[model samples]
Target: MMRSCLFFLVLLGCRTLAADDQPALRVMTFNIRYGTAPDGENHWLKRRELLADTIRQYQPDILGLQECLESQGEYLQEKLPEYAWHGLGRNRDGSSEMTAVFYRKDRFALLQLENFWLSETPDEPGSMGWDARITRMATRVRLYDRQTGRRFTLVNTHFDHVGEQAREQSVSVVVRKLSQCPPPSDEPVLLIGDFNAAAGQSAPYTAAISAGFQDAWVQAAERKGPSITFNGFKPVDPGADNRIDWILYRGNIEPLVCETVDRSENGRFPSDHFPIFALFRLP
Candidate 1:
């Protein structure tokens, strides 16, 4: 009986290991709406649990977040210990809000990570460019998927909300920087975040997509759910249905599914922007 029980335990362990080795990747991009918003009853303290629950429900392998203040990121980190997050703030010394990337540590080995300004001088800390209302930056991470033995790149950014010129220039900078670095023709390169522009209609948004990053929503084999991505503090905002949040990707990957996660429990929203979720697989 003891030997039979030992064999069953070993088989169960192998099954769990196989499940973790699946090749498909689940991705989510969210703009957390900044923790300091004086949202009255929808304050961070009241909605913190909802925010964590939203992520838990989706259970993405990789998550890109915009407008993530240190406190807010730390809060999520505390709530979800399985994910390992890294990204410096868009400041001189990473002292402010960060466009952070969180990944399942067990599934990925972070090969390299960098935080760069969205300006003429990307290496400069806290740099602003082209009439941007505030400083902006992008977080780049090169990850090796231990499960599939595949390596890919992930970038997360938050563009300026007020400056058309700044937003336009920011796209150019990102394209150029990525082109100059990373290996050639890297499959599964993903760019995600809140572009603060109207869907893929604006000039900057167009440029990013034009530079070979296909919008997952547009390329998904099966797409469903609400077209609108941002809903402020209410249940819905048709006027804000711009779909500014995006999950764009490139390389030998097939976008299997794409949709907006717009769930509210007890009339409380996780954030002003509904998270965009996508599933991709190697072709």
Candidate 2:
């Protein structure tokens, strides 16, 4: 009898441990600068490998990429077979690139995928807004975690860096759309991408925060440096500042780790803007 009781206790402990070992979802956003340069080096082909390497290093479950062309998206998809991607083609003029979301296939199953332009009449798909700096779009997806049976929405976008009015209007449009999304649970909604707005006092930033979202950097305890993600191909200069790229979250989620990745391996930046990653727990 004693031996049987001991065996049962051991089995119970194993089940508890398995439940506690579930992995947290890792997400990252990167703006690859359409894989070009001002120096006229035309190093996208070479840099593509480096970009893939940097992403592979993190092994994020979901990755949001801005300024990606259809060809570039295909290249990344081929390189990272573990991930599945979704995005719309460039705008009518073939100028605005795709905003893509890549997810690890083994961990999460894709539930839904949709894209819409960030214009005054967003429902019309390709409509452009009044302020035309560059066409903007947002990609939304529903991902289900096979391990925990958790589901959430991930929205990725790129706002106009040049047109201040467009950026502000875009923020309102995005928030309204997200507010209406019906997720499986009150599970967290993650908004990731190149926001193109600096931290503090910016209208877009203020609007987003006021709309019940929190920046991951501010939630972190040891938040250090300028928090500027735009490195401009230079080695990360701590003093040179602008915090444009971001990862924001909503609902009952807590950020465990948040940091900007310096992909400046071997004195070369993977892109003009560094990527930001955040690890979160669903409570």
Candidate 3:
């Protein structure tokens, strides 16, 4: 009877361990604005430390950064050594650069890395789709959590701001790629970035949602303030409206906590756009 009781206690402990491993995962999306501003000040070098500090405060498991340049990416990696970074290289025009994903090394292991231009031939690198606007692309990464043994795919991108057609086309390309490489049966695909399009009525947002992705902010329990993302140094006040940045998810993962971070306390905006954060749980 003593041996049987001991065995039952061990089994119960194992089940408790498994349950503790499945805690909520925190994810964030921020458009760092290529470390530039209209005032001729605030370069990447000047704001690198501040950005890193703000990010570290949140301690996100995965962070998707849009409008990141190669130099800025290197700077971030150096400043935030706890995370691993991956993304596309710079473009010819030397602007509208790639989106990057920074995953916590101790928490998640990267399974695969893939990137593609958002064009007629999306498989082609640096291929421009419709319109004479700047080129756009998406970076996709598959990550496996060491603690829970759960895996998820994250796709980050920056849609064209000037070209409506290009933005729509870019959304379609991302949807196609995700469909082809769906996340595992038990995992989900989390899409986060600076879409440069508003939610609800915007074509790009509509296209992505139509493809079965749910917006984290919109689906929140309480419809908080306007989904405005681009504060642009304006005072954080009510009625400051815009919804360009987003965190969308598909599959078994559920977003438990969603909030738009107010970085104004830093006495500086991390980027032209505000960052969005979501805490998710896998069943």
Candidate 4:
């Protein structure tokens, strides 16, 4: 199956998305496991190729990445030349892990991009909000789909992994930001990330839904593969309740399909979390 996926990637190398005609948008969210981790043999250098291969196989129109370090981003940029990415680290110096968003450059025109901390002092780059373990941020990009002449806002973020209050507030903060800069009803807004909280959880996930974003996996007509989106680099536990990553949308967007990519090179998965591949169309 892995071979088949690789074969498919080689055969279907990215083609130009014409400026006048695009049917749907493919989106993905992945926590690429920061390069600074001591994963021993499963380190970034050892797994970079497989990581890029995963993107190639999925061929997402836009990809949201969490916990990506500068070195890792450089490697991916070199490997995936067809895609363009935008984001800055959460650190004040912009030298640490970031919530990065990548898109097929030829498909979308980047109109504006901004990054805000998930804290009261949002303008302060390294401010940690509430009881959060570390500084976290959301990268917002306003993109124009030349093919469809559609404009939308895309947000990529990773909420606090440890702070209960921080996670809850993060969702509401994002919602407030979006509401302040409302988009037209037809063009959808997308937010994707490794949210650090499972679906239907009482905190931010609920807040996001209450604010009108639709969960891609939850709304999918067909769910392909395991329920556990985060496997911790182990074989998937059928009984594990590990769905934490998400691809969410608002506006007139419909989720046509959703899939969890579980491809592993040998016993080593690409990341601790499985990437989500979802197709969205404006209805």
Give the poorly placed runs of model 4, Cα more than 4 Å off.
Answer: 1-22
TM-score of candidate 2 against the unseen true structure: 0.87
Candidate 3 structure quality by residue, lDDT tens digits, 1-283: 0000011111111112234566678899988877554544455656667777878888899999988877788888888899999876536443447788999887777777787777887776667889727778778888777766667788898888888888888888888887676666557888888888887889989999988889988775544444688877555666766788999998887787787776764466666677888877767
Clashing pairs in 4: 19-147
lDDT of each: 0.82, 0.76, 0.76, 0.82
Predicted candidate 2 versus true structure: per-residue lDDT over 14-51, tens digit per residue: 11212457447788999987854454542677577888
What would the per-residue lDDT of candidate 4 be over residues 9-73, giving only the tens digit for each residue?
A: 11112444435454688899999999989998878878879999999988988888999987888
Off by over 4 Å in 1: 1-22, 237-241
TM-score for each model: 0.90, 0.87, 0.86, 0.90
Deviation from native of the Cα of residue 234 in model 2, angstroms: 1.0
In candidate 3, the residue pairs with backbone N, CA or C atoms under 3 Å apart (3 or more residues apart, or in different chains) clash, namely: 228-242
Cα lDDT, model 4, residue 94:
87
> Taking the tens digit of each residue's C-alpha lDDT, what string does model 1 give over 76-106?
9999999999867787867888899999977
Highest TM-score scorer: 4
Candidate 3 lowest-lDDT run of ten? 1-10
Q: Could you say which candidate leads in lDDT?
A: 1
lDDT at 194 for candidate 3?
84
Please identify which of the two predictions, 2 or 4, would achieve the higher lDDT against the true structure: 4
Report the error of model 1 at residue 276, Å: 0.5
Tell me how many clashing residue pairs each candidate has: 0, 0, 1, 1
